[model samples]
Target: MDETTLKENKINQQASTTEHEEFHTQYTTLNLGPTHPATHGIFQNILTMDGEIIIDSEQTCGYIHRAFEKIAERRPFYQITTLTDRLNYCSSPINNMGWHMTVEKLIGVEIPKRAQYMRVIIMELARISDHIVCNTVIGVDTGALTGFTYLFQWREKIYDIFEHICGARLTTNIGRIGGLERDFSPEVYKRINAFLAEFPKAFTEFCTLLERNRIFFDRTAKTGPISAERALNYGFTGPNLRAAGVDYDVRVADPYSSYEDFEFQIPIGVSGDTYDRFMVRQEEMWQSLKIIRQALDNMPQGKHFADVPEFYLPPKEDVYHNMEALIWHFKIVMGESDVPKGEVYHAVEGANGELGFYLVSDGGRTPYKLHFRRPCFIFYQAYPEMIRGGMLSDAIVTLSSLNVIAGELDA
Candidate 1:
């Protein structure tokens, strides 16, 4: 009776377990993108989902890997700005300035106070431009297109300022090694003043459209949350880290380009959710405006570029009219100038976060080794963690809030 009863019980248990296994839910694998517009970049995300909620995710980058660091190694120091232009194109000026500062530090060139102030203004303008892209894209992902279309005009105005300063707008190799190519012209000042006066009201309206709107708040408030501790562990910076309640701003922690001379508050959020990220960037734009105003108001009177004739080029008029100036210009442009042998690291509070340049020179025209500390690349590794347990829609908004530029990721 014991052996027969035990055999029967085992069979019954096996049948019960088989039935339970059949009833268990199965997860589906979904690929978000390498070319999908919703991804906002050329990187791919492979997601495991139960219905519409994500269970697990794997990210694949390098679809557009341009090997910017390698390119930088081959190019002369002056020509490297073109490569940086594509790193965080939304804020190319910050990348451009950061590289210039790294070279300046390595060469022991003292940047003029006026040049520093000018750099501050341009960098802040680029910051605003970068934040605008992030925050507005967040709106669009949440099905709010009005804010994006409206606020983008202001970004164009910022570009106009860039165009007036240099000849180019987007991928502006805007500044020279020691300082800017030239001082601000009257037209540039007029455009800047106009932008300052007009943008605040429009930006305020853009904020109002999404900041408290019930739909925007609900779509983003608790979605894609990361704790302050987790964000730091993942190496977050800029608005993303600030949204997680970290006040570690490169501009304030290690001031460069005269950032310390200005007055502004570092805005932070509590939950590090999508809403917090959005709000943090919203407040940051205001702070950028404040810095730009201060830089303009306290504009020091002096030469725009430092007295580093080896690096900074002479005036076009001089190059055209004077034989010596023409010869010097040809030599500098032709990579005939010598660079110091050294290693240097410089970081700027880039639009996404800390945009850093680690440079190694061997007394040559090109960098021996070069690396960029792209914030987008660092924080994007946390994307899967942020979007796990949330809806597929949440993934899009979370990425938008992080503002992970594809260019930075591949570079």
Candidate 2:
């Protein structure tokens, strides 16, 4: 009787265990990214999925981490602008300007009014280019490819403006510690004006295609919705935070780089969904256009750069002709230029959010320690939470809307 009872109990227990395993195995573990196209970056997400719905997600960064902060510590102040260029490669000028502004603050060099205005124009153009990429990508994620192709031409025109100014596109190391490396050339102004005249009409057409399109609205309107309180709690900023209905723009609140001189409205959204993010960025591009136009119209008549020979690089002609200018150029290039013993933090509204530079200098040629407050890195902390319980497609669209550039995120 004991042997029969024990055998029966063992059989029942094995069957129960097998059933449990089969039931649990129905929920698959899926790797959403690391090299996936929808990721839009080298970001990796390990998603726990029940069919197509994400039950949970885990994000892994640092895949493309070049140790930018550590690199900054080794590089001189002026040379570090190149590092900033790689931080947010989508809008490298903004990163360039932000780093330059931080160094300027440390050196106590007051930039000229014209230089400030020029910086504003470049930064706003960068902003517009960045938003164009983000919004168009959102459209593409939603299966609307027309807007992306249509607007990318304008983005190239903006890049042409950058190329005319700095002779570099994508990762443009455009500005200097005191101000821009040089003033905008006539060709630069011409390209900028042409872009300004053409982009608005094209952008309006792009908006008309998507803003009210039923498929786009259905895909984005309520998907990945986050409340204002939650977004602020997660340290969200830029269009993402503005999409959550918080109007905390660094330009308006902190007013750096003569932003106070410009008149522009901060566009805010209500639901903090993908659609809100897209719309907010669309509006931001318009506001950025307004700022750019004003900056160009009221550009002061003065030197292109501040008269800080110690910090600013001398003209190439001067460097070639004058021994003193050559010496200064060598000192500036070789990290021999003196930096003050102080700590300074400067933030600018980057295309993604507030790009901040925390510089600590012990009066050394190189920074004692440099820390970058990258907004993509900060906002990415909430990705798993944002995507949990959402469909995989929604996650893709939400990510596109967030515009989490890997350079910015991993740096």
Candidate 3:
């Protein structure tokens, strides 16, 4: 009686367990973000889930759309730099410099080598700042919060350098169309050197915390992987494209702002997953450091701003004390200065990817049409595809590693 009764009960128990598992295999819809912290931006994903696995997803953008391209059509060339600041606010200086370079190309104003080197230094710092926020946030999403808080201090130091240079931190209207509005002060150099010297130690610590962590690798290594062909077809650039094993860095492919002068390597990855994205950003921060050091050491000597007095604002002291300076300042600020009718496109190696500006001028105070090739907007198109078969948690880490800034995406 014992053996037969036990066998019958065991069979019944197994059947009940199977029934329970099937009952719980239900699907639900989830709103991943728009205001969700894991999103890291003002974008929303409508996710269809089977338990924790993301089955399908739809992305909603334009929550922060400020119509940047349309705004550029109305504002004068000089006024447009402020709008760029709002794009990739994490690395606004790169947007500022990219916009300025676009106008310079249109007007045929050659930036001095010194000014180019200065721009390079600032842009590289912005790159470091951008990568820091991305890589550390990737850690945060992976449940390692300490690294984010620890490395944020270095981000503040980078912001301090920005504040010193442009008198603003987050949205730095850093350079003018022809060149920088002002040269870097000795104090700014001091801050940069200090950052360069100290950041490596903290960065090393940050990497040590997560790079080889078993949990982190398990969560991120193969999650949200995309093939190189698909990534490139989607117009991927910057680290996102690089993570797919294509080494197409705009700074290397089409050098601008004297990026040709400084030597640095493009960081690449093979899997195009969250882990690769994080690793690529980590390596890029190091490359940015290398570029900054080279620019500082081999800086050229020349005026920070070009000789285009008509377009560039006059010195504040001169505006107050000299009549001609006052007139030029008025003309430049009021958008009364004329620009030659032409079309031009300029791109820079932005923190996200390729930050490009395509300008068409009608020989007017404002551009006839201006378009920004914001990398965040372009790469975000690949999000649903990337996260399609991944888990909900992997989606968060993938988004963090992509570094899709709302301002940039919506702009």
Model 1 C-alpha lDDT per residue in residues 51-73, reported as the tens digit of each score: 89987787888998998888887
lDDT of 3 at 367: 93
Q: Over the stretch 1-411, how does candidate 3's per-residue lDDT look in tens digits?
A: 463355445545554666645665544667777798678779888776767887667788999888888888899889999999999999999999999888888888897899999998999889899888988898899899999999999999999999999899998999887888788999999999999899999999888989999998998999888899999999999999999999999898998888888788888999898899899999999989999999989988878989999888888999999999999999998999989999998998899999889899999999999999999999899998998877788888888888999999999
TM-score for candidate 1, residues paired by index = 0.94
Tens digit of lDDT per residue, candidate 2, span 1-411? 563355445545554676645665455567777999887889888776768988667788899999888887888888888888898899999999998888888889899999999999999999998998999999999998899999999999998898999899898999888888778888888888888888889988998999999988999999888899999999999999999999999999999889999899999999999999999999999999999999989989998898888888899999999999999999888889888899999999999899898889999889999999999999988888888899999999989888899998988
Selected candidate, larger TM-score, 1 vs 3: 1
- TM-scores, each model vs. reference: 0.94, 0.94, 0.93
Which is superior by lDDT, 1 or 3? Answer: 1
Clashing pairs in 2: none
Candidate 3 lDDT: 0.88
RMSD of each: 7.1, 6.3, 8.5
Model 1: worst 10 consecutive residues (lDDT sum):
3-12
**Model 2 spans > 4 angstroms off:** 1-25
| Native RMSD of candidate 3 (Å) | 8.5
Lowest summed lDDT across 10 adjacent residues in model 3 is found at 3-12
